[model samples]
Target: MEKKKVLLLGGAGFIGLNITKFLSENRDYTITVADNFSRGKKDEYLIKLLENPAISMIEGDFTVPATYDQLEKDYDYVYMLASVVGVNNTLEIPHEIIRINTALIYNTLEWLKASFVKKVLFTSTSECYAGTIDAFGYKVPTPETIPLTIEDIGHPRFTYAVTKMLGESGFLNYSRKCGFECTIVRYHNVFGPRMGFKHVIPHLAQRFLANETPFLVYGHDQTRSFCYITDAVEGTVLAMENERSNGEIFHIGTMDEITIEELIREAGNFFGYKGEYENAPTYPGSVARRCPDITKAKNMLQFEPKINWKDGLKLTLGWYKAFFESGKESFEKAFEKPKANV
Candidate 1:
């Protein structure tokens, strides 16, 4: 009767923190959270989690190979969640995204080559198949089998997906050659509190809180299936722990697809804003429609999302509202709307 040891690289971020919280509450494991705090801040949420004696924190730039030295050579489970995320970061620093994300994947793979980690999970995104949908009209509720493509390799936005594609291939192949169990979970639109202000929900919350007279809905018709944080955490853990999931890729999201208009209007209702709504252009290279077919996860791992979109939406909006009402500033730069393309 021994406790399992868990290592969470970049575990201070939104989904990573949620995964840590879930494991700490429900599993009998000693968890180590390693992060550099570049994007994921040591905010109140993370600080509170560290109070649990079972959890420990390591702060270092994981993009550096030397930082991996600080981690133990043996781990019962390793969640490789480190990477540069968010469309804003992709747009602002595409080159840095390529550099840091590639380095993280390479360094971790090399480290695993010599380490004694039993199992590993790499978190990816739906953005990997966005090009297939946009360029070739791939089916909606896309599954893990779709070919990964980039419409414009030169576009800054697609840089994020390119690195994710690398991580997926790198982890799966590395696990086969290096003799470690590996699983991948491509997250759809997972959203919740502490998700940062750069995402759509938080941006909407901020706009409504400001009482904009006419709220603009960027890509009003574009569709996405949003998964709640807890649901995502459950699917991720299931993928990692389930014996059937090794070397398998699962789509960890709900099938509840809705339009951008629905999201914006619902967010407006939460803020009690009676404002005119206008449709506007979205970010460059933004996908027109994206959702994940989670049947593989459901059938193989019995993964199911519990929180519906509206309920999840309300919970997220409420958190953002409280955060703004407290007059607390965003640790990262608040997202600004770009001028609509003519």
Candidate 2:
């Protein structure tokens, strides 16, 4: 039998690279990783994976329609994981977030109109429903059915979610009309190594490594359910391959919710830091509590998250610790800071 042909639109990023790694390891798919390297180039782990010869790389600015032309017209599976993410960017450059993300979504949908992709997976985020939970007091461990709302539509932070909302509607409707299978997985707080320094875990690792005397735990009481990247990647692959997932939205995350204090204290323990803690204000527009109800994913796709938060957090802390000590600027920060700079 011929090898399965796969396309990953943003495969060089954190979750994308993990998905690519998992797919290439256990299957015989000829995978194409198309990334702008907006975050940065492939890391050592992803580079090592490329040596397997089943994977190939394509670099381009995917926000443009011409970028889609470089991709193969026919793919057995297409994972549309491209987007401008992170709260920093949303807060710093909401306009660019709107421009870039919207362009990427629209360009891809228009391209898919003529492409011969059999099935596609659109990666979404829990940010889509953050306002719903915060403003409406929606139940915790929110399910996929929660209505995505933004408290302030004009606010910069909500711009990211707005574009994601557009992508979700665009991909699902496009698939329905264009005759391609589609599935959506709204990720909760997925964290792991190579996730970049802008995220909470990496920042915490940095502070701990620096031995800050009075650790400032931002949003100390805010709660989230963190999912390990490996488990998230597995669930994503399952959603793409499972026949029952087409036209369905699943929450791919662990249901174990914990507070910021618990997370920080645990990381503090990992770094052997004995320090006082103080609660501090966090990013504006951030939700107070968030988690995913993954029962749909569990029952429909047998998606089970295996790594505990502390266990996964330790692994992530280790990677970020080494990276910071390397005296190297991360790819995302390097590219970001220069853009006036998000």
Best by TM-score: 1
- What's every prediction's RMSD, in angstroms? 1.8, 2.9
Question: What are the lDDT figures for the candidates, one per model?
Answer: 0.90, 0.86
Per-residue alpha-carbon lDDT of model 1 for 1-342, expressed as tens digits?
989999999999988999999999999999999999988888888899999999999999978899989999889999999999887778789999999999999999999999999999999988888899999998988888899898888989889999999999999999999989999999998899998877788888878877877788788888888999999999999999999999999999999988888988888888888869988877667788888899999999999899999999999999988999999999888767632210
* Weakest 10 consecutive residues of candidate 2 by summed lDDT: 333-342
- Candidate 2, residues 113-209, lDDT tens digits: the string is 9988899999998989989988899998888888989888888888989999998999999999997999999999889988876777877776777
Best of the candidates, lDDT: 1
Residue runs of model 1 more than 4 Å from their true location after superposition: 338-342
Candidate 1 lDDT score relative to the true structure: 0.90
